[model samples]
Target: MRKISPRLIYFFGALGGLLFGYDTGVISGAILYVKRTLDLTALEEGMVVSSVLLGAMIGAMSIGPLSDKFGRKKMVMFAALIFLIGSLGSAFSPEFITLVLSRIVLGIAVGGASALVPTYLAEVAPAKMRGSLTSLNQLMVMSGILMAYIINYAFSGMAHTVSWRWMLGFAAIPSAILFIGGVFLPESPRYLGRIKKFDEALAVLNMLREPAEAQAELQEMKDADEVELGGFKELFSKFVRPALVIGVGLAIFQQFMGINTVLYYAPTIFKAIGMGDSASLMGTVGLGTVNVIITAWAVRVMETRGRKEWLLIGGVGMAVSLVALAILTNFAATGIMSYVTIVAMAFYLIFFCATWGPIMWTMIGEVFPLAVRGVGVGFSSLVNWGANLLVSLMFPVLLQHFSMPIIFGVFAVMCALASFFVKRYVFETRGRSLEEIEATLRDRANVAEDDSVVAGTTPIAH
Candidate 1:
């Protein structure tokens, strides 16, 4: 059988991210209809909308140890099955309680995929290509979100009144594809080494890398595996805490900046600003389009500009856009104000997509050692999903209590704070091998050699 190239692996592994995007992004549009169909109060609407994130936080917390034990590929496939069940469950729900439960199932899958997909990509990708490849996870995520927008728009005119069901259920198609793809993807080599399948790890790496490069990388992973076990505990000490702070801080700030608020409540926001139902749906589609396009463009530039540099740049841009929205919206309910809101939202997404959108995943995936990669990502992802849950559950309530400008003004403050956090704590992780990143995280400038053997390879079964 021919070997699968790293790029192909990146593409397929990243399918998990599509599920993450669609399940989360679809709700923004679907919630509009859900509220109408179920006669939901704002609080109930928030609970229904945020329940998935609640499940996501749980999934994020649990999947780490499970992935480390069963392997990233298997857990990812499990997530796919979860997503499938969630899609079907959601599509058929007859009441608000059942719908929220269905969404929780889907959220579990999104959380798992979010934690693992980046790690899978970062592990398999050559250091030089890792940035662009792992960025595909975020790219696919936004793509899935954009696709949901299109689907939401397409179903807006359905006479059956089950348009939201279709929106929620459409995720099964991609989940099915991801399940199939997961079956074919290789186990992460870092995982292989952790399990002492050194030969198999070498074989997989050799298949994907040049021989000399493969051998060198194998040595580096061996060095990583030495400290991989229970590495999460060590993160609390002096030098390592900086990396932890950066990783966890980035995750928190990414959510607090209100990306999800816009993503999950754009239709509602637009409707409040006086757009009709169709117009609100179309507006989400427009922002989704902008998100995907900017993400595609950002992946290319991230490699060139370096992760930290671009993160700083993106944070500044995000703050500016949110401040613009807050100021513009505060002026009054002018006809031009609605247009300005769209422009501000679009600019915010552009800045976010170009910066923290993908870089957060890339950075988190790179920060932890081979052993703690799973746990570290899990904890950070839990933070991310938890923050997401808070923002999603509270957005409608906040909207009820405050004007759009005041609400956005709060996010603007958070966005500006995100920039300051990045400026203070973020590291330049661009162009480094995973080994080198581990070195930085361990507070060493270079990798210390560990005793390891390059195992013999057998042809992988197709």
Candidate 2:
């Protein structure tokens, strides 16, 4: 067989993120039109938009054990197939319940890709380049979102019912591409080693790394394997508790910051402030453009700047922008204020896409031990999807009962809390091999346990 370049591997491996972004972003515009046809109430509109999130929660919860048993590549390919089905089902649905069910199906694929892509990327990458490589998943995700926005705009000029169908159907093309690319991608060598296939693991590593480097890496994995036992139960063990705390905390806070409220409802918000349908769609296109550009820059710098620093900086920037946007929304409903609202939202996207958007997914992949990395990431992803579901489902309903300023202010407060969580709980995994990171975490856990023993208290995964 011919040699396959690592870049190709990264591209195909991260394609799932593209679908994840497209499915999520397309709905922001599609829902505006969808509600007209379905004659949906605020609560029913939330259901149409959030049903996929419900499916994603189920997908994330189950993907870990399934991917661990079958392998990452296979599971990802499976997700792509599901995405293709879901996209088509959604596009062709004739009624309310049918669209909701189709979206839920699509969501399972999104959730699986959300968990699987980062884990696969992290495992295949060299330690020095891991952050940049792993974040390609997020880069692709943002790109997909941008693509969706452009398509949504392209179709927004058409008759309402027809446009939404095209927006949803367009996802099928990318899903098919991801499935085909997955056929050529390599299985993760770390996973190979976990299954006791050392020779196979080394062979795969040699394809990705220098021969000597491959041998050394394989040996390190073997050494680590001797000490760490991986299973679902081990995910909650004292050794893994710290990473678990960080993973789950970031997952929840990322959504609680209310980023999705912007992604899922930007056009709606713009329309609320007195813009026409096309202008509001265009506004989201702007947001998606900013998201893609910032994410691309972030992928270049993540390896150098470190995860914790970016999270902290982005958190502060996001809170400030949201507060500013809330003030704008509270004070003025039309004229130049609508433009100002879009700008403030762009700032929030800049802070988010550059930091938490990519870093949370990247760190979750890095922090988990190889044995339970799939499940650990899965569980974290499950929480992320759950939080996303809550925010997406509630934002419209919240708007029915509360003012826009209050909603944005609440998100600003959550942004501040997320910053605090990062400062107190998050750890840097920059420039460290997966094995090295695991070893450090294990050492810390042991020391903490010893201290707790001395004090006659039990150690927790704090």
Candidate 3:
């Protein structure tokens, strides 16, 4: 095959992200229509909104091993097929249970894509451009969010009750495209090497790098696999524990900070702050717009600003924004803080877009060695989706009983802690190759013999 341009690889990667965004975000608008059509209560609405997350948790948990064993390309294609089935199933569901089931199925696809697409992109992209290329996943997600919002707006006012179904079924279009596109794309060179496909791996490497560099890259990949492949048990081993800590911590902190809570509940948050239903829905479009713009900015800065710095900036900004939000919401009954709450949310999102949003995904891909990369990312993502379900499931209850002030305050504290953790433990990975990172980790754990033991076998007491 002729060498695929880096640009082409990025294009397909973003296309995959587009499907992810559409599958994940389209439900936001459909929830209201489905609720009314199905005669759903508040609890049912929560269930409807969270069903996909349940599916996502399962999907995220499984995709890692499947990707590791089967290759990223095949797993992604399978995810696309799942997405297609889920979209069609959801669009034509005759009952609420069916719709929820479809959403869960869709979640599986979303979960898989969330784990695999960025990993594939990072492996294929040059280290210099890895941040930007991986970031395209976020951009595509935003784009999907934007597309869903527009489609929802267009369909929300339609006279027919079936309009919402159309809004949702539109996701299948992108899912189909992704599935077909994935069929034509090459598998990750790293995965090929793992399976001992030396010649094929060399071919992929040559396509991804200069011809002169392919042999050396293949050799490095082979050398890195000399150690035992990582498993669940390896997660607790001395060599892998730090990476696991970072991965799981990143996953939990990302959700605990309440970014998805805002995304999933933007309209409701706006309505609670005194905006009318129509106005709140329109305001959500603005949230999507800002999310897209800031994510674009993050893509530009990901490689430029070191990862640790961005996490600190994002953490502090998220905390400040959330605290401001809490204060605003606490007094929203007076109407004075309503607009302030909106602005605070906007700031919170901006900070997330700049830092935690894209960087978390990028860092997850970089932090683990290849042997355990799939499992680590999968486990972390399962935690992320699981946390997503917990928060989404409980946000309504918390809103009703605890008030927005307490809820957002909790998130702010989490954000503060997350920032501290990132600053203290996360390494700067800009421009570094994966092998170099692995070498650094290995060297950090290497044991040095004492001079007395090495020279004469004479022991000295301290």
Q: Single out the weakest 10-residue window by summed lDDT for candidate 3.
A: 443-452
Question: In model 2, which residue pairs have backbone atoms overlapping below 3 Å?
Answer: none
Off by over 4 Å in 3: 225-229, 333-338, 447-462
Error of 2 at 441 (Å): 1.7
Give one digit per residue, the lDDT tens place, for model 2 in 35-94: 998899988899999999999998887875588888998998999999999999999999
State residue 326's C-alpha deviation in candidate 2, in Å. Answer: 1.0
Superposed model 2: Cα runs more than 4 Å off: 227-229, 457-462
**lDDT by residue for model 1 over 1-462, one digit each (tens)?**
237877677788899888899988898888878888989998999998899999999888788658887899899889999999999999999998999899888888889999999888888888998888889999999999999999999998874459899999999999999999888888888889888888888988987899999999889877663554554565454435666787799999999999998898888888877898899999999899889999998777668887878888888888888888888777664588888888988999999998899999998988876667788888899999999889888887787788877887788888888888888888887889987886675544212111111233332211
For each of the candidates, the C-alpha root-mean-square deviation to the true structure, in angstroms, is 7.1, 1.7, 3.8
Reference-based lDDT, each prediction: 0.84, 0.91, 0.81
Model 1: residues with Cα > 4 Å off, grouped in runs: 223-228, 231-239, 332-334, 444-462
TM-score for each model: 0.93, 0.97, 0.93
Candidate 3 lDDT by residue in tens digits, 234-336: 7666566667788888889999999888887787777777787567668778888998999998888788788888889999999999998888787734365
Clashing pairs in 3: none
